[model samples]
Target: MTAAVFGHDGPWTEEEYLALGETQQRVELFDGSLHVTPAPTPRHQRISRKLGNVLEAAAEAVRLELLEAVNVRLRPGRVPIPDLVITEQVDLDELIIEADAVRLVCEIISPSNAATDKVLKMHYYAAAGIEWYLLVEQETLTMHLYQRQGAHYVERSVTKAGAALELTEPVRATIRPEELLG
Candidate 1:
């Protein structure tokens, strides 16, 4: 499938923006503009859900929270719904209503969103000061992990079916591609 194209324009408020969501293409309000991309296919969802479950189960003991496709506010009104998020257990009061940022952010890559997930979104996560960022490539069925190094991120490990990706504090379990992409 081809990528979804959107017209470039000034940023809009959260209330005024998501209400104008387009039916022609999938779009995200990034920094205020409509960052568009084609819809993810079934295979993409399978991989994403698979990994989310693994991460969630592994984090149960530590009380680390697993957020799935939840909108997060970075600045006053800036928001983006990451595919997966790992964070500390905090009050639900400000969630979904405030600009709450998490410590770790992760995304599953689809063919139509390869660039957005790998590049644009990566930069966005860093700019938000997230500690760890993860990229899961469904095409290759592997996980690429990164950790912030003084405001920048260093690619820590790339794990395949035979191996596992190590997680951060609170969630000490490792994730395997077989458990994620199978």
Candidate 2:
């Protein structure tokens, strides 16, 4: 599609946003606005792959699925593609995973999108009633875990490099922040 089809005039509709289809960048919708981000660095992908491996086993043990970079529809006109999600099994053929099915949403914070991942997405995820939120800091490999309490998220745990992050609510797992680098 041409740039004209995207229309730079008004806030984007869900239909318009989805019609963008797949691009080389990461595109998300929030309150009818489209936020486009460039593809992550190779280091980001490496950390994501390693951490997903660690979480996948824990998720599978409880019959949940671990997905990476999936479209999660928090609501109409609000869809943020989280870096990782551990969720109840849904139809893989579907393009979007509803918010309620998600048990945990994880985002790896790079210097470029730190605020969006740590603050903006945190608010949206908690508002959507997602039970768990995990944040990983790229440079230091620090991990923060939060659980929803009422309309917001409460900080549950923080694990730095060389430490173990033990989680029990969404699934049972122990992760070391440093291990995610390799």
User: Candidate 2 — number of clashing residue pairs?
Assistant: 0
Candidate 1: clashing residue pairs, number: 1
lDDT digits (tens) for residues 10-53 of candidate 2: 88888888878877788888998888888999999999999999
lDDT for position 140 in model 1: 80
Candidate 1: residue 57 lDDT (0-100): 89
Cα lDDT, model 1, residue 138: 84
Most accurate candidate by TM-score: 2
Report model 1's TM-score to 2 decimal places: 0.80
Q: Candidate 2 — which residues are off by over 4 angstroms?
A: 1-6
The Cα local distance difference test for each model comes to 0.71, 0.91
TM-score each candidate: 0.80, 0.96
Off by over 4 Å in 1: 1-10, 18-26, 91-101, 168-170
